[model samples]
Target: MFLECQNINFRYPNGSMDVFHDLSFQMKTPGFHALFGPSGVGKTSLARIIVGDFNDYSGVVRSEGMQNLLYSYNLERLPDWSSVGKHLEKITPPSLRDRKNELIASFDMAETMRLRFSQLSLGQQNRVNLIRYLLQDFHLLIMDESLANVDERTREKIILGIKDMFPDTYFLYISHNVIEVSKFCREILVFRNSLKAPQVITVNGQDHKLGQTVSKDKLEQTMLEIMHAS
Candidate 1:
């Protein structure tokens, strides 16, 4: 399995609410996966747990490689007024350092490479954040609505571009956009109920007792049906 979680349980400190209960699943293949759920249902929490951010949870969260990367909606903490080139240098690794120019060009970020972080639009900043990760290696990449600020067309372009650029890297994308999920993801993990195990929908041309793989349009329809039923 590329990633696995077993007997997971968690809640915030001094809080009466429970975030998860006995949640478990295993991902054997490497590809794009969509994690769908309403806001505040522990979607972000789960991402953080997978990336080793919050260790307060009780469970066995294992992956083929310990190295994981995460980018989320919150950009308030990002450096203000820092030159784009400077910011990129700080996050990019030494091994991938030489590929910085290549990545920037591929993402159509060359024209704004010299602009300050605070000067770009919200969508531009998010794109920059995503480009930084593309230069590195990770066992799993978690994007918690990192592209929410961007428009739908641009978002789709970037998402597809990422898939093409990093064919081998696994992605766990948290989103509510059904079309995007159906078009880009090979598997769907719907967290409809907070305490229950997530319902799985695979679109890798694999037969399963629950559902069968189909065309992107068919997959979208099937996903909507399942999501509404959930």
Candidate 2:
């Protein structure tokens, strides 16, 4: 067991309602894990909790065998750069970060490195948005709807690159599409009304269906179905 999260319960300080409760999870290796749910259902909340930003939560999130086993890079405040590859050199260790030039070429972004991030096209910026995380050597990689803002072509290319290049890396991916997300994940974890100790659906295959742990007759409609149905 490389990662363990047990009975994690949390609520915003301003509000008493819990965002998550009694949620348990464990991971042994690097593969993509999608955190899919409708808006305001605590997908961002879960990300914050996992990244050690929200310490007010109950229960322990411990990585016993792996020290500092989590890493996430988001679009907000993206490494401001006149030189795009500067972060590649400054942030990552030399031995592990030698793939800088290769990544630049692979992303088709070598020409734009010298220019500021503001100067890049939308697709170019999206590619750089992803590279920030790809350039690192962290055990758990989390992306919070990172591809939503980009073009379909760029998003597909980036996702393919991530899958092919980072085989050993575990990705905590986030998206709302039940059908689309299944392609990238081996196990589909469903969160229903995720702000309040929601049920989790464990799917056997990469089938993108509206999966629910609680039987339809046994449960009330949740944000998951509500979003899709609407």
Among the numbered candidates, top lDDT falls to: 1
Per-residue lDDT of 104-197 in model 1, one digit per residue for the tens?
A: 7656778887888778888788778777767666767888777777888777667666666666778888887766676677676666555455
Evaluated against the true structure, the overall lDDT of model 2 is: 0.63
Position 66, candidate 1: lDDT: 49
The models' CA-based lDDT, in order, is: 0.71, 0.63
lDDT score of residue 161 within candidate 2: 66
RMSD of each: 4.6, 6.5
Show how many residue pairs clash in every candidate, following the order shown: 0, 0
* Clashing residue pairs for model 1: none
Residues 102-160 of candidate 2 have per-residue lDDT tens digits of 66677778888777777777667767766766766676767877666666655555666
lDDT of 1 at 71: 45
